[model samples]
Target chain A: MALTLSPTLSLRKAPSISDEEFRKLRDFIYSKCGIFVDDKRKYLFETRFGPRLNALGAKSFSEYFQILTLSPDKDKELASLFEMVTTNETSLYRDTKQLDGVRASILSKIIKEQRAKGKFELSVWSAGCSSGEEPYTLSILLHEELGPELRKWRIAITGVDLSPAMVAKAKAGVYQEYAFKTTPEDIKKKYFTPVVGGLKVTDSVASLTCFQSMNLNDAAATKRIPKSHLVFCRNVIIYFDEAMKKKVVSSFYDNLLPGGVLILGHSETLHKISAAFKPMMLPGAMAYEKI
Target chain B: MSKVRTEDLKPGLIVSEDVKSPDGRVILPKGGRIEAFHPMLLKGLGVTEVEADSGDDEKLLQAAADYTREFFSYANPDSPVLAELFLYATGLVAQRLATGWVPPTLGERMAQNVEHLSDVLPADEADPEKIVRHETELASFPESSLRLKAELESPKASIGSLTKLIGQDLGLSAKLLKLANSPLYNFAEPVESIQRAVTLIGLREVSTLALGMATINYFQGIPPELVDMKSFWRHSISCGIFAKILSQAMGSGMNPERFFIAGLLHDVGRLIMFKKLPYASTEALLYARENFVPIVAAEAALIGYTHTAVSQYLLASWKFPAMLADLINNHHSPKAAPDPRLAAIIHTADAMSNAVEIGAGRLYVLPDFDDESFALMGLPASGLAKVFADYETQAEQTISAFF
Candidate 1:
């Protein structure tokens, strides 16, 4: 019997980004948001934006670039684009060593300084706080430390991210199980209530934090943030080039109070970017202090 | 001591063995009393059965029989082959329980390997379409294989007609005959005639074999420089053999042929990646070697998706059965699978295949066995000795027949 053949399944090739288009988009993103996409990350851009092109009905990367720049709704498109390009990989108590350092050294020292100065208020900033884990973790740590004494002192934790979607999620304060991977069971039980699909941060923890959509590249907007006693800008600077890193680090420097601590991701460093902050080696982690 | 299905297990029953969770952490130590929450917790962790201390040998044997009956109560196998499989599995389970056997702990290095991968590749990037596009450059069922599948799917299709149709393709026919004569069947004499081969191996089995052979032929041109094709096939074929044996031992009532094909094709996505994205695949392999992690984790870090996810995408796109797609997708994490037993079989088979060192050069780190999956299989450490012995007895004949 002559076989009736079905059409062979055609292979769907991924859309490739050309050198010129890659450079154009890379430069535009860097200029607009301080995100540096090098030649090696060309594939990352292609994978992320390829589907966006299809969604927007753009024929090529150059056309997508045009839409991003020239469209009247460029602000909204750029915000959405920021959501795609930024890596929001974070969880509660993500780095145990750093968190331990905060609990043992940084928090203790800061509380001592505040008490000596007769200051009854404290402020913390969690830059690029994707979905609010860092700020919430800080709040939880403070709650644990203060216990009943928390009612006497006013604490403010401001979480800022470039992605409005993430800021919204942070405001909602609900997180899936992945967020609790590193969280101790006792802490989770004490601070969170079981909700559908995940745990919801209690009103107490939620009230301690305030979420805002602010781009780090927006100097005017960043200047408006209150000077914090501690600033966490972990894992956010790796995407920026050396120049952009310096710009962001300088902004962080200005945003922190004197003797305030700055914590970066474990692998990230301010070695070549900034000499203003002195690196402090803590028990299990490294932090930078503005003297 | 006797094995009891998890559903039949009541509170106060003594756990005879240390029950571990899917991630290999011990949840219940040996001689612990089952509490109200213990069974629920175990069920949540995908445990379906546990051995209980029955006090006496006779009582233990009775409990084992009762448990085995309860285990197979949902299965109403009409075929003699399936009935024999149930008997073999029940006997094995009882024998192990009688001896108070325990499974060996997985290698510490293997257990730690997947953590490194998970660290690099967070679970959020498992996009199905992107996975398919990135891995599969060009994949399709061969013309002859398609026709064979169509005929098999038809309700009125006969073995005689399938034989004739398959015979038209000399390569497929010869492959089927060789498989039939191989130690997988344990036939006394070599099966030279295609009709007899089809008769000896059921129509479904033959059709599955033909499709697998056609697939191997279709992708025969994947560059050797990108992958050691010989080692890849050796690992694949060993996994197939192991899966078939495991399915029979578990009394899963699934077609062993389907299990064989699923095992053979479980890593098809990895092969496609090697062919289409050679540079990236090489980087992933190198990363795995350098970091002492599994290749799947390296692939996830480098490419943002593991081969298992890619395999699921390809299988779903090709209109394979949803069960098959889900089985492949959760093979690496069997406790997450909706059908944990089937996933456990494949997962264990994959690990055992790697453990035998059939294709050691290509695989850097052996995949860890899911402790919950091992528990669900109800086999003991001694069972591994028997499986290895069986594989040694059949390995040469089977490899020659398939390769």
Candidate 2:
């Protein structure tokens, strides 16, 4: 009617997460491969992304998500958004039980089998090593088990992850004391010094572990870590599908030396993916050895 | 309890002055509270970001009380609106607790009071006896399969089913039986059979116990979702506790035990609706937000007839009390209340239950309330504050039994 029609901007209804934006964000995640998003994950998006949308002054997620993909002029914005989304708030020695298993089954077998075979050079790879905790924990295990032999031997503790943000955190070698909650009082005294923000991971433990950004899906990147004597990849692969799990398991198999061990999350089992390894149940955790 | 200072109060608020005159009725007061969010409910409905820390309860209650005062402005006898409202607000509380979810908004409370605001309230010249309807067995009955089943099934069926269905799952069964035999129900030394459970709970209450058993059964097998079964059950038991107290207040003739059962179940349909069509329930909740209708109407529009009707059928099928069925079907519509006294008592208590939450925690900021119907019953809203204090104590004792 070409009559003046001024629109009302807001309604009483709450600003909700849009399904289209949810799917775009979800598909973007699934497209990165090795993941499946279920209904439970819906709230996570709302909690994580909703604030970012409001900050951008976008009325709906559709406008924001479109801006995310189509805004070629906004590449830096895209990268920052991705960095924020993927960063998991976790600490070193996240769960001590699995670390204990690494010490028992993984190190003992490394000593008995690899130790005597003139393969005294034992390499342990900590996958998804957020902020270098797992790799440092690996260093602690080597010091605990191999003792004097730890420094004498070529013990390379390689920490790898996909997130550039996490990789930098790992390289920075700094953490909050809360991050090392499970670190025994003696270990906290030895491995860390309380600083302004949190705790600083000492260079002694820091020197043993090298941090790098490597996507699991990038074959060339993943292949760089060759023949690790022991692999501590606990609690990370839970977000992956069965096929991705098998792929990662096979990758871990390839990365390990013959009879090298693979440690996984407490809730995971390797029986379905690979018959190549036998599960060695430890007192506190479970591990698998290459047959 | 004593009121605290202004500085001790939270920011962002209004207040409703106590407006009830010596003759009893006052218009709506200021500073109304909304409702609580059982955590998952916030996510399901997609409204997580709310006010800071949310503890301004007394301000909210005062607001709700004020809204009531503004709503009627003053009493009008021709207007059964306030009477109907007391009925409806009472209905909402009972239903929400029974369903194990919180009603996101409290438009229902406002609507319950003002739908007939034009109608006059209790007359100053009106005899006190006439104003108070004390007929306990006033609920009507009709020949329907619903009514027949309501009569046949053992009120004890609730206890037996608990033992059977929930018992099949060892953990819950043990918990149910343990609680059933606990001091609350007072089974001399813990009887084993459903008959014993029925006998202990008595015919009047077995239905509610059965519902309790059923709720644990529903939530147990499934993985944890937004519905916190523990908190949900506790809220339902809280409603059950309030219903029991209010039933006693309805004078002697009313079989308050039946009132307790119905009050515990008025919103059982919501659980089924939420479980069956989560998306639909979410939509209905959305509509509830848009229209300011309570959750029941939201449920009815989404799933054709409120859960009250569905629960009525279920109870009827299970052979519960006839009045219990009406209580479920008409719990929210106090004007349609067949047994007005029992209905009013439960209705009032339900509104007050949530209002107390508003008063205690700033979860929902409710307006202050007028006191005519409550005073007629010898229980003003102030008395409700006292009753709630007592309820808080008793609620503690009873919650563990049901949960």
Candidate 3:
């Protein structure tokens, strides 16, 4: 039979955002939380906050912007907006190419260097870890790569997030089925076991990591965290403005030991932000090493 | 797992023993299921018996293999790059067959063809240039598109003017917004307004996209007997997506955006032929299918000029960028173009789209391929599989955006 095109696309129309509405929302969000939404990314304001607008039955982006600026529940709405934009609900083995680069180049070099120094301990930090996926993924990789030799090493992976609720979730060590979308079948089977609400990370895997709630913006609080051989603050830096980025990046640089590495999101670059670290381009990924 | 004779074990039965080749290398592992084709492999191994699971779904396996064999009969399965694709397609077909998917019969297809062709007319002109010249300009080409095209060419053009011009046509604005939001650009921020879309997507990109969509909408009413519109657009969109991806994968510092526009309109000449010379176009299609030749060859044989020629003329008349028109014209013969690498990208993209069974009609005919074009990209042959995989999701979303 001749194929009939589906009508799904035309059935739902995305309410267009006016330039004024976009600027208002962008400025408001930036002023409120310092999450600088670039003018080019005006669409993000619509797409991310679209659900909130629908839930409130707001007619237009302007109406939604008005609610955000004027309503008594504005604080609550802003929090929801923040969560929507800053969502890190990523699956296991997210950014496989970058992770592959880390395993092949960065981790191996760091391990060899540490071994040459006769240091058996390795400390890693997942700043804004978001429910522990990033840190736990690192633990899994380190365990898989190290194998039997892992027992002799003192490995510490600290996962920190600003939201206490997310820290609690990370502490629970449970993940739904969706969490393993990118995870290999053998890895999923070996590292996770079926539990009540979801699959629980195996004890051995869970033992390598810990979760805590600490705001990245707090200078003293960030410094209190241990100095690490590698710092992973991916996808979290997009929420900050230029000044905030420089500040947070400086904090990350200080948090890393000499010759330690820092990794950001694939699209995120230190271009025009800071020039302190030396950038290393790996196959399909990049890492910054502290001088 | 229990011991069973090789003859007794059917497809879908799990193998309990490691079936090995004459060289003693393991071919199938203990947990591997026996496929319909495995019997031949086992016989070649000179093994008469093997251990396997008890139950088997022989009928379902045979049905799947039969469906896949017929579907891909035209493609050369021996090609190293396409071997994985054929296997992937077979597995997918097998899953669908298990889910109660049934192949449509010849009579059903014919009936649908008659319905589609009911409105089709006879050929008007034989010469390609004359056909294009005699054909009137697109009556429905939006005034906004022409204005936007002029603006895009000007050095002093502002994003505000472009946005206002695009905003004049709600359909154009939505298309731009969807394209911007779609995984094509994959921008970190959402594209909400026409202004933002212009600033983010760029003036040339936005203009070419608008022209492409407008042209598609103009030819929407083409008789399905000539070419199913939805399938045609799907093929075109997929080719465009593949071209963009190929350019990116090449990492040769070529502009992928131009490749996308070129690929999207590569088959546009055929659309003209279908509209202006319906019966003749069908003759070419049937000739291609019956003779097992690429459609371009069939069109060239029957009509004396291929669709690319018609497409080039039509695009040039419509004021499309010269480079895009040239790319479309030389897609079937890439090495001859001024920028061979750029033309090679489109050529490879077109073939890849056809190899994966995305086409302008129900009949899937593999396009004539040139290994030199692929070689020009400098990408590993292994990357082809990943390219095909990426094309599926991106094409799916991009096509839906247009509709």
Candidate 4:
């Protein structure tokens, strides 16, 4: 048979990130910003940055990654990059299973133990408080748990974030209805008052919490945070590299009382991080107890 | 006395001890009798559970034991090797039932009320080798997997070449790197590069894992009617997790990943049977369920050979690693392997996965546990709790990573 071949088009439509490009970019991002983008989320890089690459007229993901590393405008681009990934969808009752576990097994147990020692004080540090939903939710839980006896105890719930803007919004104590996606209607009616644009957190819950801007990487700043009986750092450590995770976990360990607990994200574990905290399995979640 | 959630509370439960609110107020005193309204009252105060005598533990355990016995009708649960497994399985069933886990019921048969399934699913004289030969598509392995297999067999293969080969296949590269970072390995840092992943998760181990993933991905067109793909892979991944954990517990110097690979592909022959001989396979499945016999026994009775024999021929024709081939071939009869102890680890792992009901792979009847192989290991049944938990977590991660 005579040679017969069909022609093909070799035009590039959209830039796709090769495996090597993904690895290189993630490594650079982790080293510079402590945000480790693992392989499971590799597709996220392309989806997030594809439009940016087209805007910049970059040829491929490798080219875009090169511009990010070598171009003089890298710092400006990095700012936008961080801004894109950090608009979190934190809600009133995120991870309800873990919250349920805390309410069921942990809170009362701690209260009973504290009463045994004749202490009427409770402290919780909401590391990476992220616009205040977490600390406010926690305050709601504490208020609901303690009921009318709340005034008898000295309660301090400190909420901190790396961004000052987020801290400012958190301190505003205002949220739209979208924030109550998982919140029960009764809880919303009870704990929140309707405002002009949204519902503002009632003062009872707001009074128990204080928000400020603080960097976790800054050890000195972390040290200034009050010692806590419980540290809520869910879904925050995934952004950090190994060294940063160790530093932040060690800081949590140092800031917790002897019998305090540390709760990470529902899926996060302290494996190969430290042996100082003993893992206590609750109903559907795990809490790390300071040894 | 048992811990009852506030939502599940009933009247007439007597409190075992004082139930206190979060503020140190005693909600219910010791020996206090509970009424219907107490559950809601306690829930309002955030009391999630109370220790009360429900007087149903014995009845629940008895029901669970009966369920377990019916579940293992195909296996000799009273055998020396299986008695402890059966007891532990009963406890797990009871625990799950207490937590409102409903057992899956085989609702209705498609070919309703057939007195003899053979009338519907005609018999076939399907030789194992003939079945293997008929499936021509599986013979053409994925290109990346083929190259990796060859590189593994070659003495001159270097890590650089291996990395380059894997990097070319984006799916495999992503899977391998993700697996390296998964809790199964618990690497100290994020594994971002293929080279680092290979180095960290051993050169041979990573290559073998990639091979396994590629092999699994190649069979995408298998009809859903033949099997539920997620359920099948869940069974495979759970078996692999169990094998790896069991190997670690044994402290044997062998590479645990090899056991994982063997367990993962141990059911490859069944997949081939389903693809090549759907009618006979359906007959075997129905026969096993109706007669309360293992699928292997049903296959051997109906088709002259089990899926294990089919797997042996397929792997041999593909020139797979000799040890892996032998492990898959003799999994059903581990006593015949050269290193019966190693083969027995996979055997016991398979049994444990089935006992825990991770996924049935549409094999409703439990497989026969090799008593001789299990007796060779000298492991306590108590240790299996940790193994089962570890397998569950890792299997979930692996499934999510691939699918």
Which candidate's DockQ is highest? 1
Poorest stretch of ten by lDDT in candidate 4 chain A: A1-10
lDDT tens per residue, model 1, A226-265? 9999999977886677788898999999999999989986
* DockQ of each candidate relative to the true complex: 0.02, 0.01, 0.00, 0.00
CA lDDT scores, all candidates in order:
0.69, 0.53, 0.70, 0.73
Backbone N/Cα/C clashes per model: 0, 58, 4, 0
Give the per-residue lDDT digits (tens) of candidate 3, residues B1-403. 5666655445556787797776788878888877766766777777767776543444454554445444343333334444444444444554455445666453222222211231122222246676677564434345665676677577877777777777888887788789889988888999998777767767776776766666666677765656667777877888899999988888855667778878888898898788776645754665555433467766754455789888877777778667787789899888878888789888888877775562222454455455666677787766777787677658778878878
RMSD in order of candidates = 21.2, 19.3, 25.1, 29.2
For model 2, the local distance difference test gives 0.53
Off by over 4 Å in 1: A1-14, B1-403
List of chain A TM-scores, every candidate: 0.94, 0.84, 0.76, 0.77
Candidate 3 vs. true structure, TM-score: 0.47
Global local distance difference test of model 4: 0.73
lDDT per residue as tens, model 1, B1-403:
7786675554556789988787888888998877656766888998877877745534544544443332222112222222333333433444455456432222221222111111211112225465465544455657786777676566777788888888899988888788888887789877888778778777767777777677678778876655668888888888888888777765656678777777777788786566555544655665454434457755755555677766766776666555556666777888988978788877877766764541121225444345566667776644654565576677778888877
**After superposing candidate 2, which stretches have Cα over 4 Å from the reference?**
A1-15, A73-87, B1-394, B400-403
Q: Tell me the interface RMSD of model 3, in angstroms.
A: 25.2
Off by over 4 Å in 3: A1-291, B1-79, B84-88, B98-124, B137-142, B221-226, B358-362
